[model samples]
Target chain A: MIDHIDSKIIALLGKDARMPNNKIAKAINVSEGTVRNRIAKLLKKNIINISLIRNVNQMDNPGIAFVGLDVEASLKDKIAMQLSKMPEVRFVSSLMGRHDLMAFVLADNATELSHILYQKIASLEGVQFTESSIGLKYFKYDYKWGRLLSEAK
Target chain B: MKNNLDNLDIQILDLLEEDGRASAKSIALKLGITEVTASKRISKIIKGDHCKVVAIADFEKCGFEFLLPMGIRVHGKQLEQVAEKISSLDAVYSVSAVSGIQDLEILCATKTLDETVELLDVTLPAIKGIKSITPAISSKVYKFQTDWAPLGND
Candidate 1:
């Protein structure tokens, strides 16, 4: 369970992951040791991750597509596992709705996107049909999950 | 926007991707470069707006039990307007304009089934010019890689 201090620390880190412990301590009015220990605890619990994320908009000719799959009921989980293993598949999730599974694929260009959608994913045994949406522009990709941390029980 | 990054920049990014807190001195030693160069490159990458070094919370662990991917078909010229509105919602993590049947795709995080239903049934429909919505709840998330550029380049 995350307390007030933990949420405060998380909010600061969400803005600048590289902010020094001393700086965070100053900002949050906590000791450097406290902040350090809290961050360590958070990491150990897999509650948060501190890492570098590339801005997709900065890349040249980057192709990002979301492919929704209708699959054989019995093979949904098996097929999702296979999609997860593909290098180009960045996000694979088993869904409950019109599509049994949804996979987000990232590639170099449109040609590669087509290949992944048609040749690779479509050929999977359980995939009955696929509907893909190529992301033309990214309006927002906010990773500041800190504000919502307070809502966590 | 095209990346003007050289080999060294990519290497530094790769190291940072593994550990965002990896010190400039440690990165320099690992890549056989001067500490000043590593530090400068790190500043350049970040200050230049190439990428961000940030903490990403796993939604499930952070009390968000539902990850809903909703596809919205907008009414004619309201695509941009609708996308902007959806992006403003606190629950929305991402909103992107796409090609094909849907005009916009959004990934939303909610805490319960009731909230998920409210979002799909009540909240979204209340917004004007939304032609239709197709919603899906992710039962399990297998992979969600944040470092796409480095991984794709390699």
Candidate 2:
């Protein structure tokens, strides 16, 4: 269980993942060794993933697409796994709605994004219908785990 | 290199991705550069908004039992307004304007199925210009991360 101390440590890293443990220890009023131990445990449990979140509009992945896929009901799980293997496909999820699977795709541009949808995704087996949504604006992209880490445990 | 971030920046990002709290001294040693150089580069990368590092709490452990990738198809010209409203809700971690079936996409999580239902049925219906709402819960997520690479490895 993530007690209040763990919550504070996680919150500090959420602010700046590269923040030194010593700084975090001082801020959270915990020993640096305690912070270190807790982090190790959290990582072991797969409770927290410390990774880089690049800003949008780079040369390679200048375009982002939200592809809503309606796949063969029986093959939803199977197809989702296949989609995950694609390099351009960033995130894959089996969803319940007009679409059976949700794929967050990355490409160089609009044309490339479209190509991925038509050539790559559309051609895949069990991908019955695909509706591609090019991501326009990201009003909110909070990776801070706000509610969970901010308030009291 | 891609965008304003170069190969070295990507390497640093990758090293840090492996260990978010990796020290500049350690990164410098790995990259075969001066510690000052590594720290300076990291500072610049952050200052330029090339990337950010954050703690991604465990959703299940955090008590977010139901994770819904909910889409709201709202009436014309109301997309931004409705999106702004949704962004205010704490459960929502992501809100983006996307093309296709849904005008707005939101990744919102709640502790219980009832709360999620309330978000779709009760809360959203109260909002104006909502034509339809589509909600999908992910049973399995194969890949979910935010990272870019210079050689197109990400």
Candidate 3:
């Protein structure tokens, strides 16, 4: 579990991952060494990952699609595993509702996205059928996980 | 503005994507450029709004146990209003106007089953323009890449 200090550090980093350690220390009222040590610990524990995320809207010809898949009950996990291995697949999750599995795919255009959904995803063993939704506009795609940590028990 | 990122910008992005905390000096050394040049390029990339370097916390570790993906059908021409309203919710991580059966797709993170149920049963339904909602709970997440694919291979 993380303390308030750690949470503050994370909050700052969530805003700008490359924020200087001394600046974060000054903002959070902690020593630079303390900030550095905490971040190192957090990264080592796999509790937080600092990385760069592109704004998908700014890209050209990027097609984003979410696919809901119906698969044989016994092969649900297997099918999810297969989908996870595909480069086009960004997120794959096994579900318990209308769809047994769901995958988020990204491609260059509608044609590429169609090829992925029809030619690749649908051909996977045990994939009964696939329902797809193409993303038109994204109003919010916030990856900052700091605020959520405040509510964590 | 659309990203007019050249080869050098792309390379810097790739390095930062691999290690967001990589120092300008280290990046300069690795890419065979001056530290000042590397620092300026980093600023240009970020100031241009091309991408953001941020820390992503693991949901489970942070006590968010549920990942709820909801398909929402809007009640008429209120798609924009409803999408914007839902986007402001604290639990919602993403809100997208989508094509196909559902008018919008939302991905939410919650701390417990009760919170998940409350979000689906009460909070969302209370919204005026939401026609209907189809919600699913993720049993196991195989992969969730925060990085957009167009920036890198695959």
Candidate 4:
């Protein structure tokens, strides 16, 4: 179980995973060892993972788009897994709505994106309908889970 | 030309990708370069805003199963303002201006369906100019990766 301190620590680490325990402790008013122990426990429990992740928007002109698919519900999970295996597809989900599966893909250019969408994803079995939206710009792209805990309180 | 990462910088990035907290000494030892050189390269990469180290929260572990994949249509020219408004909400993970039948696409996550409804039905409606919202609650998220690498250039 995570407490308020844990959530705050997670929030700080969410901003910069490389933050030292001492810095986190100073900011949150806790012992460095306490901060370190909480993080270790969080990691052990699979609650959080500190990773070196690239901010894709910062990358030059790499094609970023969202592809929504209406798949045969029976094969929804299978199709989602298939799309997830593709190199271009970064995120895939089985969803409940007009579209059954949604994927976020990245490519070098429009041509590559077209190839993946038409020749690759569209050709897959169980994909009943497909619609895509090229991301024009990111208004907000972040993953700040701990903030939710704070806001809810 | 203006801002580019050479092979050496890319290699250092690769090392950091595996472990962002790897010290300059450790990176230098692996790459067979001086610690100062590794540190300098790392600094350059950071200054260029090429990448970052971040904590990835597992919603399933955080006690949530999935996020809501939503498409919102906003009225007139209020799209950008509403997007910015939604951006400030912690319930949302991402908000993007997308090209298609829908004007905006948002990813929202919460601990329960009630919270999701509160955010979508109550809070979001309070944002002026939101025309309509179509949401597909995610039952399973197979893959979600933030770590990225630029395509190779010669």
**Which candidate's DockQ is highest?**
3
**Native-to-model Cα distance after best TM-score fit, residue B129 in candidate 4, in Å:** 1.2
DockQ order of candidates, best first? 3, 1, 2, 4
Model 2 lDDT at residue A128: 85
Off-target runs (Cα >4 Å) in candidate 1 are: A144-153, B1-3, B32-34, B149-154
Model 3 regions lying over 4 Å from their true place = A145-153, B1-3, B149-154
- Residue A41, candidate 1: C-alpha displacement in angstroms: 0.8
Q: Across residues B49-154, which tens digit of lDDT does each residue of candidate 2 receive? A: 5567677786777778877887779899998888888888877878889877788887887889889888878887888888888878876566665564211112
What would the per-residue lDDT of candidate 4 be over residues B1-154, giving only the tens digit for each residue? 2258898899998888777667889999999999999989988875565676667667666766558889999999988899999989988878889889889999887888788778877998899999999888887677776666331111
Q: What DockQ class does candidate 2 belong to?
A: acceptable
Over the stretch A78-107, how does candidate 4's per-residue lDDT look in tens digits?
A: 898789789899888778884888898888
TM-score of 4: 0.89
Query: Candidate 1 vs candidate 2: which has greater lDDT?
Result: 1
Across B20-90, the per-residue lDDT of candidate 3 in tens digits comes to 98999999999999999999999999766678888988877778888888899998999999998998899
In model 3, what are the clashing residue pairs, if there are any?
A: none
The worst-scoring run of ten residues by lDDT in candidate 2 chain B lies at B145-154
Query: In every candidate, how many clashes are there?
Result: 0, 2, 0, 0
Stretches off by above 4 angstroms in model 4 are A144-153, B1-3, B149-154
Provide fnat values for all models in the order shown: 0.74, 0.71, 0.75, 0.70
Q: What's every prediction's RMSD, in angstroms?
A: 4.7, 5.3, 4.6, 5.3
Ranking by lDDT: 3, 1, 4, 2
Which candidate model has the greater TM-score, 2 or 3?
3
Identify the runs in model 2 with alpha carbons over 4 angstroms from their true place: A58-61, A145-153, B1-10, B148-154
Q: DockQ (C-alpha) of model 4? A: 0.46
Give the best candidate by lDDT: 3
